[model samples]
Target: MHRLITVALAVALGLGAGSQAAVPFYDTYQLQCRANFGAAFNLPAGSFFTSSTPAINNAGQVAVNLVNVNVPGNPPGVWFGQGGTGQVKFVAADSNATIGSISLNHLGRAVFPQNFTSPNGVYFYDAPSDTSGLLTTQPIGASSFGTPIVNDLGQVGYRVSFLGSNAWVSFAGAPPVAFHAVEAALDAASPYSFLFTPSFNNSRQIAGKVRLGAAGQTGENRPDQIRIINPDGTFTIIAHDRDSDPNSLFLSFDNSVALTDNGWVAFNANLFPAGRGVFFSNGVETRTIAVNTAGIVSTIESFGPAASASGLVAFRAFENNTALRAIWIGDGTTLRRVVREHDIVPTDLGPARIDQHDASPVFGGSITINRYGDVAFNAALTPPDNNQIEWGSGIFVALARTPGDVDCDGDVDFDDIDAFVAALSGPAAYAAQYPDCRWLNADCDGDGDVDFDDIDPFVALIGS
Candidate 1:
């Protein structure tokens, strides 16, 4: 069987040059919830997701924040759901307290902050145990806490603000530690302060943006810099606005930063004098993933870019000329458009147009991408009926097509052999033969291509 498969793969490669049809890159788009419509708890009338970014873990579990607009104070709540599953469940809600943004871990645990209960601070919800509890409160002398994120080890990192100073604190089953504080000196000449909300990775490293002056300094005097605080209390500066190297220079950085376990820092910033772009660096080398230019992106949104452990970065931006907002994924060399404003997507409720009204920075819905390249986001939808714009907001997920599932049956098996060959023949031929499946399913190595390098992995998956 292996010999025959190898021969078939060779022949398919020989035929690759014959076709050039476009193939779909993703396998599914799942709608977890829509305004007035959800598989779990029914949202209050006129409820919409607040300006909190959605979070997704490697396990494909997603958590998002919700707000009831009809309510006088716009009370908040948190909702949880899984990819490919239509069900969404209410994790927690408080009519009297406003819930902060949330972060999910591979263990299906979520962390957020709220003041509704006593000892108001960051809280955790364990999906497996179906229980919730307070993870930690404000550190001693800290007046408030915000932007809490949980890593796979269940450790929580957040920003703590005092009377006039701010610090980034991390908690691991003990009293939180302020790893970095405002007005701290990055070096002899750079008295960097004012840390932004940070991204935490399993390596115990926290990455964030900092201004290069005292806390209250504004404008160009306090230029932005990206730094990663290591586990041993040491830190590395990845990029600086004042760097003499033209490649590392930037006018300013967005407040958000994403850190991967491998130490890549992903962010978006304004280019000096003109243009904006998304970038990722390893503290030694910086790479531009996408930039604003004619016929390409016109404006890259300032909401921090999301980075996966595998080094892929995802961000929201506006397409050039058209000014259409879109969610994009890149691997530092190639970019793929995930979804765009006004694009009609298939939903369980039927086809709906992706309305950008609620996806703005003011409305929340920042993009989140996992290691598997799955992107989670919130958007307002216009149903096929074209009515009911008020009940249009929804949380949606785009599931990346799994490698080797060439037949698109949600699995890899013996039946996929012929379809796999067709996919290798070229996207055009593959689409002609299997119009419903993605040619990318043949990318068993997940290198963003269908080629001979995938044959061995494909065989192993079926053989196992």
Candidate 2:
């Protein structure tokens, strides 16, 4: 039966009658973090994460911002730790300053804005050297700094707001350079009047949203645009408000955009006609990952879309007609739910429900995904075993499974061959055969598909 199946598959996929080239084998390793609510790092008792957004690097290091709610006058601080390890250390804390959103790079370095401080500026903390310092002070004539994102090369990108102008700047251990500034001519016909949500990738490319036209120009309802500034200082518009084009599907985009190293940008936007959804584009083509529908979701949260270099997108959205929310990951064709509100999560303390509080205004949790597919996030949890000790909000990482593990049995072997073939048949057949496994496990090449192209890679995993 195995021989017959192999011959049929070879014939169907148009493989010639010859020995196939040796496909590189990717070693299967257990993820640093488990699917359970295992904390990436432990927080002090009674401390809660203030910012739901946590950043993760490809090395499985996680960083977050939190505050000690039990201590009066206690300052919020940024913390860093390795996934699935409890050894966590503080990056920075100040009683007189507030820490903004934190971004981490593969070097274990984190960058964030230290607000309300003397010489308020964006700061960096190097975990290996145990050192922290300011990266750049506020640009002259700037009122504040937006969230700063650090790339692997130690370059930082952020938005600076002036009295009446805003600009996106990139810093590389020296003076900052403004790549795009308000009142700068976007084209011969208009100037960019507004910029928001600047992001950086390893290629030194910057992506963000912009409004074309003069600042405060009346009767100018030009839709916002998503643009990228390339390494050569050239610009490319990924998507824009093209309401006049009958073929354009996007009506308007929200203020959130996430850029991946592979030059893909993920965002949330209002769809044409009426609805909201999460979509991604690579400057040439755009694809939808999820959209609000009657029974699936009522609204997709605009603030929590994250992209990965492996061509995956993660997002948060509310369940239809319910307050419950869920985190989902997609590769354009396949969507998987990572977790949801009220789901039980097993922790070091015990099992707890993924919960939220009315006091916390952040509707859905913030999320981030790395090149390796690991997702780091922050969430409030109901105390395990009804015990509040050492419990409140926590940072966690959901590590991705090894490639070609179609059965998701922790290892790739002969046991997965049938399931792999089923997955190649289609997602429905794969799910019908392996209800608990993910169809994405068959995406061996990591090109976001399960087809004949993955056959050699899958064979390499189990040996020729």
Least lDDT summed over 10 consecutive residues: which range in candidate 1? 15-24
Clashes of each: 1, 0
lDDT of 2 by residue, 1-464 (tens): 54566655455434332222111122221122221223422554445565558888877788776543224566666667784563334434457777788899999899988766666778888998988787888466666777899998998888776654667777777764655444443323336766777888888888887777665642236657788876445788888776434467778888879998878899998887888888889879888888885446667876758887666788888777556777777766667667666666656556755675443422235788776566776666665444233235556677675566676544556666677888888899888988756687788888888888988887765553
**In candidate 2, residue 68 scores what lDDT?**
33
- After TM-score superposition, the amount by which residue 340's alpha carbon in candidate 1 deviates from its true location, in angstroms, is 0.8
TM-score on alpha carbons, each prediction: 0.78, 0.74
In model 1, residue pairs whose N, Cα or C atoms come closer than 3 Å (at least 3 residues apart or on different chains), thus clashing, are 51-364
